[model samples]
Target: MSLFNMPLLIQDTAAIEGDMGMLWMLISGILVFFMQAGFFLVESGMTDSKNAVNIAMKNFLDIAVGSLAFWFVGYSLMYGADMGGGFFHWGGFIFSQGAADLFFQTVFAATAATIVSGAIAGRTKYTTYAIFSIVMTAIIYPVAGGWEWNGGWLNNTDGIMPAEFIDFAGSSIVHSVGGWAALVAAWMVGPRIGKYLNGKPIEMHGHNQMYATLGVFILWLGWFGFNGGSQLAWGGDDATAASQVVLVTNLAASAGAIAALLFTWIKNGKPNLGMTLNGALAGLVSITAGCGNMSEGGAVLAGLVGGILVVLSIGFIEKTLKIDDAVGAISVHGVAGAWGTLVIGLWGVDGDAGIGIFNGGGAAQLGAQAIGVLSYAAWAIVTSFIFLFILKKICGLRVTEAEEIAGLDISEHGTIAYPGKRQREME
Candidate 1:
């Protein structure tokens, strides 16, 4: 099956048959479900313990709130019906999908909204963040999602020259959506206290690398579903495509980790495991948009470039932009997602581009990808900032400085994640 012409799930009836297939999908969903833990672990592990519980709680709550929001309005708006003018008409305020496909997408909707939690961690009030999460899953994400994924104007399906912008998974649709939101939130929240002293960056190390590492592994495991399940079945076109997608994803991740490790070691004169793991994630995010269209070699190249992009983007955002992302979510997801989306034009199989830099050199496809990038950034930034601004005016958006220094576990939730250590400090 050609990349652009892969069979839809509805076309292949037998491909979805048997209890085994259903089991695979359900299990895949479960795995993807557990990625939330991975996000919490990885993010909290990268930041100080003072904010560990805060980060974890945001991840947990965003999923809870975002899921409900997506079910109510996001799914319908994103996929219900394509408006004539490239907008998605809101279907309704209830959970009613024409098929199981809608439910599957809801899980992805939750994933996208949850990605912002880590970016705005350490400062955002729980209530404010909760409202933002709800708005994101229910409106912002779904509206943009309809643009490309659900046959919106961005699809270019009806243009004079038929052009279809493809996102194999969700480089822009989910990751970039969350990434841009993170950018806006981080900007509004400002840097964490003491994060920038005298206009210089301060190192705020994570409390636990173990938690972060475990989170990376869980995300890696979950990505199998993240990409594979997009094929929408376990047999025939879906099965074959899923298998290839997994292969490419794994190759990209491995290459990314290696590239990041080497680059970090070269620049810092040490093997930065944290950054190396992040590189792996960067590669995954980069490949997500074009995973179905690229060959093995293309996948590796994408991963390698993605690894470098994350390192640079993170450093730039933190040091230059003065944004305290807490978990590097903006770089790993936002920058890398843009890379992945553009890679489709560069390395797509049908394109004149060869397997490497020599083969796929065209500007038209690049322009199309750029359109997707700008669209996502504009929508996410504008809507996120407006929503957060409204939230700040309505109910306050940050906890007290005293509450922050004392730790969110105690101040926000009135409990300690590590009671023993907290007691020791108190005494």
Candidate 2:
């Protein structure tokens, strides 16, 4: 389907499936909202135990603050009527859109902002990160999202290009935006203390493998709504499309996990659990953009690539680039998101209709996808850098060196994730 031609799912209560569609959207939004918990667990488990409480606080603020920011300003800028000649938009402020649309997209806004949390988890000051989340949801993410979803220049293909940009559920518009921001945040925050000793990356293992594992599981489930809900309706062809999207999403995730598990085993002689968990997330993000357009086989291929790329990207970012990402968020979301968006140009489809170069489609679709990917990356990196740099200069971004040793849980927030250990020490 053309990006502009996708169903809007506006209320048509007289239709037989109107209620069903509305319910589907609400349920999907709930599922996506629940992914916040998944993010909380993933960030906490992957980082130091001492910072778990602080990490949780960050996640809490991400949704609480992000939702309001998006609602008050970002939503209008994104979904409102175009007012910037295809760049800026203005709707009535304070979320006048349908409850379902607002609810679903609110979760997505929160999600994009929260992706930065894991990358800068252990070291960033909560106040700095909190303001960054507001800007992310209220401005950065919304502006990029408007370009496509709101029929900005990217989707104005009739006037600007030969084909439309496709991002069924925002691999680039959401995940890549967040992913790139995570990279910048991590860079600005600098590596966690002791992350690099003598310029060599040291192992900073997560405290709880089970938490990471379960977090991925929750995110995996949430991806069904993330992709399927993009269908925007449950009646007739929309139902079929939604089901197909869910199927492809599942296939891609499974393939991604298996690929990572095998890749780690072959490379290191150990089936690393962490790689496997992130592999699943990489798969979900990979197929998110093309799930509606790709066949089952194509989805698996994309997911496998996403999984492999995440592992490689993580290594390059940490070891070569010397950026410390607490949980590989940059690789899983940003790098994999770019790959997912570009791969659609290679092999995307609409049932039997071809929309990909390798599948009998022309390069127009590919070109559009490429532009969208680059646009998202550029927008995210530049905006996040501007905000974080200013924050860094004005007040500060990271915790004190003493606080680094003390851990943010105690220094930032007077609490411990595992109070028993502290209690034993005091005794």
Candidate 3:
């Protein structure tokens, strides 16, 4: 039928519908873009005072380098026509599949690339970090993303989870991927000087709590987009799903923050700001995988569980494993990502609940989630080790002891972030 002959109600409604959907997607994308700043402050605040500026630079540079790399190759490797028999594929170069999808994927690509910066914060050379950023965006992250988000093996119909596996956003694909890489990088780089003493733990303090808190708030704000944008529609079915996703995401984060705060208060006899802050993040990470499909109540349960788990896991890693993760990135991202992915098989409530204990399903989905988590962890650890080892051989991943002790702010960048003269190295 001709447009002039079409019914007025149908035509008017369709126009409004299209406009609203576009608006929603655009706004969500913008919010996700802002998260880069949030991550910046959080990482910067977690480091020693001597290296704040250097940390900030690494965060910024990762985005810059990551964006370029993703634009050139990563997007295609991830979302282009799948190859490598659905295992892994190398797609063509820059601007593949046009500009729109590349821009959207670039933000996510950079986030994954940025995660390692926190773990290696105190000792990495700027040049080394920059190079690794490119590798992460162009190779490591894209290949992993292909397996899940882009219809590779993890998300394939013949795959492990198949009918039951789900990740609405990227709890496992993004956060866990980043965390796994961070874990390996930290171990390879070794602990910061004086972080440990003959197997004893030493306290390390942040330079600016104020900046870190601000960063947390920013991250919280950005999460709406992070989860919502995954719907990929501005309105109608997509928008409806996006709204539900945002609601669940917020609930989980809130519950996580509360649970973490209470846990710390009882254990330490006082409210711990850092732990509280991380709790909120823990909730967000835990919900990322299932935000689109979970009920409000399910989100709360996931958030609380994730927050508490993050606290315990961080302690275990630091005390038992003795991994020197400066900002608790590994625990908050890796552990929580795994939990969130599994939680979906339990509490997911939308049409695509997959399979869940709550929905009369047993351990099938859970087993699949576990496989996905372990596979990502193993792959990330092995590849990260190989990548860093090569970097060490060729250009040295770590700075000299003198440079580390002096602090990267001045030693690496030739400027003290703080105004006052600095104290001597802790030794």
Candidate 4:
């Protein structure tokens, strides 16, 4: 009998559903992959022009290295058969039936790993960065992902938590994990040379505001796929729900940008462009966890809070913590991601599923969200510190003073992003 004409195949609803779902997932994955360009532009534009080439190189290599690492072991560790009571998994090595799913997940792993690059830019050794990307995608990100998305203890229906933890698209699992790791990495790498003077941070401005603004817009575009694709299905009601998710995502991003612009204008007496850009990102990260569950109003509220928190957190990290994050990745992703995840416990709702505390669900959901947030932070911080410390001892994490001042493009890559008129004049 022909496969297409088989009665069982024709009658199977799941088979038809899988076909559309896979196609949507692949499309979404491609959109997420394009986010790498966004990251490159944002990182390069936010840092010194001297390091622009190096920044671009790192971002490119992050996807390259992260994809291979995830394919080799990361996917298996995340989605393999449950072992040791869901602490980890084994098997499913190489490729399996879900190639499309694997491709989709690989991009997400890369996104988490790449978030750290901006924090340690301008001063990191290229070789060391490569190693970090591999380890992060293969081990750090996958293990955390297993815990939430792969039937691990955190999201287990019968787990220790009062209520199942909710991270619809990994605000805590992906963003916070990356953010916490970036925090540790920035600390270990130390601040860039001349970043501090007399125990106070010296102001450093990005060389190109236009590039940074363009990057923000690109990221905003990519986020529709990032949040919408998490629905994991594209048939019937799922299609409508995905559309709603995209709508809320857009609203949150706009609200976040406006809030940050106003807040910074009030505080600094002028609207800071960089802060405003980050504010949009903060809003996006804040809504990622609850976009599918929350109403548009809830998303705006979350984004508004995220924008204010990011500005405040960036100031604290710079002034009080003395952590020099070149692009504020830690504050925008980690802090806002945590805030977004926690808000789900307060505002999350899906039709009749009242799972938020303020919606009369009580403290169970809130407690679960808190536990998930803390666990991810602890795991990311501890593991990142250990890995960074070892790498520092083995190969050294930062460039020398001469190398840094000379610019990573010239010192590390032996090329300049912009040779300027000197080359033309010489010719």
Candidate 5:
């Protein structure tokens, strides 16, 4: 059965394609896994100095805990054989057949779970946070993912929706699911001590803006794989499609950063670094859903809109809603993600149908995208609320008032991120 002895015709053409796909998936998965580092840096840098180690620990634990949870249960719930009319998968628990595929998906699951950590940082009990991570990876994220990615009703070609919901690379499945959960979790957990003073919000600037900037850069680099690899194939046209996705993804991120910079400069009379960083992320999230199907121009527009939206959304969430998201995770991921998904209806280009309302495809795709957004939002928010409520009742979600003042690095992890610096007194 040596290859040289085998007949040329007997060798499978599809097998070669499969091998290429696996290699691409593996590389992309590795890239996505590195995003955890980006998250750690971003969250830690955007918050107080004392909580840096604590934030880093949670981000690290997300990958470790999430991988195991997804392997044992989440993968099955998402991609296993469909059962109960596609509401869930019946089997495939603890499975290992497609190693590359499993690895690729595990990173995505971890990402969804980690998004919540940033929102609830500093105040959460470590034990409760660990449990939340497991539940998100093993249940919440997987179930929401199953709806579209695993051939559930949302993306079902012949479902009740006007057209299939198109989330090219998980704008809704990964980002929005994470975002909505973050929002719910942040709201339920309440604000950090001194985040609001006398019914007015107070600004708690991050300890290290340099770390946040570097983290944003790393996340931008990782997004190439995040969107490009969603093509799921690497041969012929698939290769071309993937390359285009990477290009547009970059364009959108750039446009978003510029837009946010300009907007903030106009509003604040100075260019704010934090808003600029968030703008770049907003653009990336905005274009993720439609990257494969959008023109470069459309991507630019999406990014521009996303960048502006993020700034406004952050203000609204902070001022009007009074929700304290230490890193603006909910606005950047949830709000921008929803916009990106919905934009697909206006900008998407695929097949003979042309796939977007402005592209002569009518309102079918738009309607579907809307449905997908609302559905995922409801699911994520409700499930997150229930889980957080239960945890709040059973274990109490927050540390004591004394713990809040002492910093989680000392109270939770028994060490300080900056060893010698005097602990700043809580205002």
Candidate 6:
């Protein structure tokens, strides 16, 4: 039918999609921004109450310090003109016209920085963490992210990649970067005092399971925007793709939570609330890479596996590796992020055909996924290790043993999260 005869609701989205996209980005940015509160709650509630205020301060630092760094320098490095054949860039520092996109991406950089906070909670020096937060948001994160997101060598067009590396909502870019850095920070800071004694692990339960549970619920609610808004548009085919992203995201999270709940119930003779919460987050991370290309069944499968894997991974990191990750950030984000990225090569879809090996695609896509996964791991590990090593040697990465024993809230922040629960000595 002619446009003049068409109904008002039938206008092509292309006529209005630009504005729609900006609106969506702003909405999504707000949602992603709220995740900061979620992180604060989860990290605080999952760790000792004595350290709650310290955790609160670190989370506060991540968004506050992290955002300014991303704005002034990181964005230019990531989105400015490529300077060294995708390895370097310059210009656009503290400047940009695309405000909506800029705000959205800024939140992601903050999210990456905050992951380290939970892992290093309690014993790490707050000033050192504040510095690391700046380093991550500015240099370490942006440089690696530029490689793919900014059309750098790792992207398919570089002629080095065997296939396109897909990470629709940043399972690898955002989550894994934070996860691996957390791994290094946890290792370098050296397990929390008395976390282990003579080669045996000790259980350090989080002070407030109720708060942790609430935190997970908030994060789950935010994922809808995190995944859906990644489509970067709001009409035409963008509409359908965004809808699918939301659907798959939810399904994966549900499956992840269920898998963890069931597994712990069977193995531990009861459901573990902590593990279950992490499982849901793992599922969310797992589906993030493939959400745009996955079917409902694929999303569920990925999340279920991610959920089970997180439980196993947490145990191995804590007991076997002896890395004292207070909130299990490494497993739920890093390990699950790698799995999420790699699963695309196993059963991910392209148009109507599967891009994964089991779906009739060759090993090429899998190879690419593996390469991307390894590249991120190595980059995050090496850079974070060096930075943290320096911070440890020069400025001190951890609190004094006495300060740790006293609890970071009192020792570092000069306050407590729950003052009523503490004795005068604790204060």
For lDDT, the strongest prediction is: 2
Candidate 2, poorest ten consecutive residues by summed lDDT: 4-13
Worst 10 residues of 5 by lDDT: 3-12
lDDT of 4 by residue, 1-427 (tens): 2211111100011321568888988888898999999999999999999999899888888889899989989999998889888778866667443777788889899999989999988899999998999999999999999897877889665768888787878898889999999999999999999899998999889888899999999899989889887877787777787787788889889989989999999998999999999999999999998887777777888899999999999989999999999999999899999999999888677554556777666888889999999999999999999998999999999999999998999999999888983377569
Which sections of candidate 1 miss by over 4 Å? Answer: 1-24, 157-162, 351-361
Q: Encode model 3's per-residue lDDT on 1-427: one tens digit a residue.
A: 2211111110011221355555665676678778889988998887888898898788788778888888888887787776776667666776465344466678888888788888888998888888888888998888888887766777555655545357767898889989999999988888889989889768788878888899999999999888877776655455566677788789999999999999999999998888888999999999998786666777888999998998998888888888888988998898899899988677455453335666655666667677788888887888888988999999998899999988898888998777654534332
lDDT of model 5, residue 203: 94
lDDT of 3 at 259: 93
Q: Give me the overall lDDT of model 4.
A: 0.86
- Which candidate tops TM-score? 2
The better-scoring model by lDDT among 1 and 5 is: 5
Q: Rank the candidates by TM-score, best first.
A: 2, 6, 4, 5, 1, 3
**Candidate 5: how large is its RMSD?**
7.0
Could you give candidate 1's per-residue lDDT for residues 247-290 as a string of tens digits?
A: 88998998889899999999999989888988999999988987
TM value for model 4 = 0.94
Assess each prediction's global lDDT (C-alpha) against the native.
0.79, 0.88, 0.79, 0.86, 0.86, 0.87
How many backbone clashes can be found in candidate 5? 0
Model 2 alpha-carbon miss at residue 323, Å: 0.7
- What is the TM-score of each predicted model, taking all chains together? 0.92, 0.95, 0.91, 0.94, 0.94, 0.94
